[model samples]
Target: MVSTTTTSTTSSQTTRERVLACMRDFTSYQATRVALYKEFEEL
Candidate 1:
């Protein structure tokens, strides 16, 4: 039972880290996209 609990905790942390990484990547992509669009509008 203890092992199962520990395994689940580890899995949860991993999943959280994965989600955070995805969010960070998405935010970066959105910033780049906005910058490109703004540049295009200037033309």
Candidate 2:
């Protein structure tokens, strides 16, 4: 029972980490795209 609980907790943490990483990556991509668009407009 304890092992199962530990495994569940670990999986949850891993999932959370993956979600946070994806969010960070998406945000960075948006920022880069915005910057590129602004530059294009300036040009």
Each prediction's whole-model lDDT (CA): 0.90, 0.90
The reply for model 2, stretches above 4 Å from the true place, is: 1-6
Task: Report the number of the highest-TM-score candidate.
Answer: 1
CA displacement after TM-score superposition, residue 37 of candidate 2 (Å): 0.5
TM-score quality measure for candidate 1: 0.84
- Cα displacement (angstroms), candidate 1, residue 38, comes to 0.3
| Candidate 2 CA-lDDT value | 0.90
- Reference-based TM-score, model 2: 0.81
* Residue 35 of model 2, lDDT score: 99
